[model samples]
Target: MKILIAIGSKDFSKPTLKLGMKVAQAFNAKTTIIDVGEKISEFSSQLVELAQDQLESWDFDAPGVDVLEWAFNYLSQNKLIDTKQTETGFPKNRLIDDGEGRKMVYLSGTACEDVNLILRNGDIIAELREEVQFGEYDVTILGKSRKRNMSHDLLQYINSSLLIVNDYEDQKFDKILLPLDYKDGMLKVAKYAIRVALALNVGIDIFTVFDKDKSQKKGSNYFSKIIKFIRRSGVQYSHEEKQGEIVEQIIKKADKNKIIVMKASDMSPIKRFLKGSIPLSVMNECDVPILIVK
Candidate 1:
């Protein structure tokens, strides 16, 4: 699986980097680390203040002390990026494969353009989104909080199998909650969840929410394949049926230590927003990190 990781404000918070690295190693996946650089304007020559990221507190002074410079230094300090990559000067717009075929890729794009110039000169958000799409990343890891509307749009667009790394103390998770509604392609979701569950060495709870009036036979028939798949994988799991709003049910049942894995709807963006589908609802309402498989 190819994974994309976004650094907050183009800076490497050690915790964030460690968390992303752990996740990449867990999946044994190739990872792309991206940072959007805010440009230095003539008016703000002393420092660059990006209103886009609401980074007023940060002083982006020139000559070795900006976030971009900071990123390279951090990588070098942590031995994430080679000293060669840091020599001379780091490029403003760079796409490096790193050649090592290691777990992480180093990427940075200019986030200097304003909204008025976005059409002619693409902005940072657009550039970041484009890179992720170009890489066809299977999963993207980002901070729990995203400030800008454009950042949110990027998230929604690239919502395919997202793992929002919220307060990740460790890679450890108590259990994984798989919310199955018996939809098509659910077996794939189940298998994916099972793989993760196996990796985490945690039991999987294959659950569904439905009214009592509905026939148990239908739920049993629908989940039979998925159950068989999980059983074959030898993943310890329990199946449960609850009755309530899907989002509410999952949130209440999912403990703080549990990671929730659910299948996301691939409906059109506008349509999905209007509908506020169960997955979206869970994403907004639940405090737990969600692994949405599309």
Candidate 2:
């Protein structure tokens, strides 16, 4: 498998690269380091020179030479190279395009580029997954913003075939959570959950949560469907049924390094607010990373 590290304008991307390398080593995958940025500036000659030295030291051949030339050209154009200052469009377009069929995109900022998106670093750490995109790879690892209290600067690492880390160590996920709602969409989500279960040598605890007395019969049917999903994944797992709030129950089961895989559902405004946004809720309360697959 090939993992691409979106080594863009974020300087903190080094940690992500380290983590990604670790993941590649574990999954026996290849790492493709990529970067997209505006031209470098003449005023930052020292920085540019430093980068040139790096390229030379690595003896980075043809493709690397082309990349450095592009950086120099961007600097000549007097354009900003940072992802944060851009107002043109999604700063992640390049990254996301590279992410096609990729495990996950390691986003650096708390909230994504668009929307009122905000993420707690701890929550993001908890939600990391090593499998995504129909069991193709693990989750994408991103760094946090260097802003305000946003700079947690914790040496946390999320595991994937494309692992990114700050130091040398094996951080494997040992437990996983699979929450299914039996929606047709969930079928794909189940495959991702099962893939991680097997890859990390982790035990998967699958659960279904629903409104109390709302659909006991339907819930049973859903549980059966999820079982089939797990069986198809060819992994050993435990199954359970819970009657309670969906987010709360899922959060209760998550731990650091525990990946929770769930289908992305369209939610109403009130529901989003009440649940406090499923992704946000889990990110905030779960103390683990929650992987939401669409």
Candidate 3:
């Protein structure tokens, strides 16, 4: 598999690059480190100058050659030596074109972060995926703040586009959580989850929850519908129906490594209320990745 880490001048560049390096090393995936020429702020520029000054003042000889050799060695050691410096006067457009066969594009900020808006690699890549029907990438990994849960709109967009990786590196998924309501949207998500599990060769623990105060008859009907959906898929899976708060029960069973795949009808409103935001909450509370299906 090939992974492309879209690098630009931002606070997120280094950390995102580090994370990408770790994953690429683990998966033996080919990586391309492309630096999209974007302007840097005055403060950052000053910092760069100060660092350069210190380097010049040092007793070390051939500092420039050392730096280049270090970067080359790092990339070579990890089999990620493919480096492309974009100076096409259109970074984002060129990035989308370069991402033709990439497995994923690790993005930072949204459209507001870009000046031209057209050069926003994240949005442009998304537009490319929508317009061009080349299923080159399976997921676009976006880093979320460890401080709080990500916004609902972000989560929703993430769910539909590709697999979103937050802070789940510490927890590798052993089992997957597929929560369904048996609606068409939920069924679609269920199918997506099945494909992911198959790709990862992992077992899925499918489950559903209903209002705790609902009548037993209604609960039974919901359970029957859920079971019917799973059986209809003919995919190897196990399921359970429990009565409790939707998010609470879902979290209770989740370990550090187990992923929860749930369907949300309204990703925007859920982002605000943090209700019906099972995936977001899971990404926040658990150190596991939440795969949201549309």
Candidate 4:
């Protein structure tokens, strides 16, 4: 698996980085930590290389380099990076511009498959979308944003599963709340929940919320298959069924203590764009971390 983690600042991104690395380690994923700096003007962009060389000579780092340096320190302190790589410290001078609007430095990882720190400058969503396409990442992890339409744009445009870390407390969460349906992609959602449950040493709450406007059936064969798969994975889990507005029920049940895992909407892109979807509503309403699997 390959994971992309987007971070903005040192002050607010610790929880995101902390949780993102944990998830990457859970899957043993090749991980990239990306910092999207403010976009430079055309003139500044042309002179960026010269500025970087001058900054390094003056014992100063270029824009976004400090964030990468901090990330490297966090990995080294946590023993996530290989000891040999940590000994030399953050390789600020080795950050290479690949001529693709990305500057990156690679490191060996101890807990994950590998680690790479990347710097880019552009609109956050645009840079992230391009990186996801270029890397073919399995998941993109980032902190919740207060910017309007941030969540909607990410869920709609990014071509990978997403984990939005909101109010993450490592010791506070106790279970993975997996909202299920008789949908076709539920098995994959269950698998993601199982991996996270094992990673956090938490149990699973397999919840099925029934829309009052739709069928009121108890469960289906597909739901049964999901339960069986969770059981076989050896993760402790409990199941429940409730009838109500799907989004409201999920937020009420979550109550800020569980990590939510659910499938992305299967509606056509146009319909989803116009009418929105269940997972998107939940993401906006809930305060807990959520993984929307695509």
Candidate 5:
């Protein structure tokens, strides 16, 4: 598995980085940490290279280099990266620009397979979308943004599964609140939840919500299969069925102590765009971290 972690800065992104790395470790994924910097104007873009050269000559790192260095330090302090790599320090000199507004440095990892740091200049969603496409990442992890549209765009456009880290405190979370349905792709979502639960040493809360106007489905063979899978995984879990608005019920049960894992909407892109979806609503409304599996 490959994971992409998007971070903004050392001050605001500590929790994001912390939780992202833990998830990556859980999956033993090849990981990349990306910092999307403010976009440089078209007129000034040509001079970016020259400015970088001048900064390096003056023993100063270029823009976004500090964030990468901070990430390197975090890996080294946590022993996530190889000891020899940590001893040599952050390889600022090795940051290679691909002439496409992207710069990257690679490092050997101890916990995961490898770690990469990338710096890009552009709109956040565009840069992230391009990176996810280029890397074919399995999951993209980032902190929750205050910009409302950011969440919508990420859900609508990003190709990979998403983990939105909101108010994440390592020791505070106690369980994975997995909301299941009889959808075709729910099995995949359940597997993802199981891996995360094992990684975090947490149990799973298997929840199913039915509409207020409609009774529960009669033959839930798929739901039964999901329960059997979870039971065999050996991760402690509890199952419950509820009646209400799907989004409201999910957010209410998630509270702040549980991380939510649920399937992405199966609606067509046009339909989802026109009328939103349950996972998106839960993502926007819940205060806890959520993994929207695709």
Candidate 6:
């Protein structure tokens, strides 16, 4: 598995680092930590004076390779190169300069064999748009402060699964709230939930708000498939059917502390839920990290 951890220094969260590592270690997946440095809108007086004849300007990267190297070394020296899984790999490290007056630092490929790093300049969203889809990243984990979450074009438009890290605690993903509608993507969404559940050593509660008569049979088949998947995953889990309003039941059943996983596709239920509500109220109001699968 490949995991991307993005750090916007202004809203950087230490929990993001911890959660990234925990997930990586749990799945024995490679993790890339991205440090999106500050942007320079204008050239500095010293730089301008030094290169008076120069018309072109480029992004400046600070502590790019050196900083990431130090961090990777720290993790290795501390024997952090370990996970519970038998397989382990770290992606390769890369430093990139977009030459648009923005810098980045990438960390990866320490103990993980498949891990890779990437550094980009200019806007974070622009870089993501160029790389995330093209690279086929399985999951992207990002740190969002209380003041900010997934409100940008990059996050909103990405096709891969996204794990927004926020309002987190030290090991509190006791149960994952999976809101399903017995659709084709349910299994795909469950795949991600399995990864998270294993990573956190938590139980999976497969749930769906049904329309009673219309969904009972389909819901049964859905639960049967989900049960088979989770059993194969060798993780503790349970499936239940509820009759009520979908979003309301989901919100009421899921507290702020539980991890909620959902797919990003334009499913009918999800579309109805979002259009009936604000832009991302189900995500924003929950006050918890949401895993939106592709």
Judged by whole-model lDDT over C-alpha atoms, candidate 2 comes out at 0.46
Q: Which stretches of candidate 1 lie over 4 Å from their true place?
A: 9-16, 38-125, 146-155, 211-217, 220-222
Report the poorest 10 consecutive residues by lDDT, candidate 3. 109-118
User: How many pairs collide in each candidate, listed in order?
Assistant: 0, 24, 1, 0, 0, 10
**Candidates 1 and 3 compared by TM-score, better number:** 1
lDDT of each: 0.60, 0.46, 0.48, 0.92, 0.92, 0.61
Residue 16's lDDT within candidate 6 is: 66
Kindly list the per-residue Cα lDDT of model 5 for residues 81-195, writing each as its tens digit: 9999878799887899888778999898998989999999889999999999999999999999998788889999999999999978979999999998766668999999999
Which residue pairs clash within candidate 1? none
Q: Could you say which candidate leads in TM-score?
A: 5
lDDT of 5 at 245: 93
Model 1 TM: 0.68
Summing lDDT over every window of 10 consecutive residues in candidate 5, give the lowest-scoring window. 215-224
lDDT of 1 by residue, 1-294 (tens): 777666655433444555555555556666656554443456863343245224423533322224445555555565554456556554433423343221222433121111000111125556555656667877776666544453345446773477665555555567889988766779868866876676667889888887455654365565788888888988888989887666778998886877788887757778865665677677666777677776
> Which candidate order results from sorting by TM-score in descending order?
5, 4, 6, 1, 3, 2
Off by over 4 Å in 2: 1-31, 34-139, 143-172, 212-217, 220-223, 267-276
Residue 53 displacement (Å), model 4? 4.7
User: In candidate 3, what are the lDDT values of residues 146-246, reduced to their tens digit?
Assistant: 44633444554332333445444423666778876544446566666665555455678887776588743333465466557666755567877788786
**Over the full model, what C-alpha lDDT does candidate 4 score relative to the true structure?**
0.92
Alpha-carbon deviation at 228 in model 2, angstroms: 2.1
lDDT of 2 at 80: 22
Question: Which portions of model 5 miss their true places by more than 4 Å?
Answer: none
TM-score-best of 2 and 5? 5
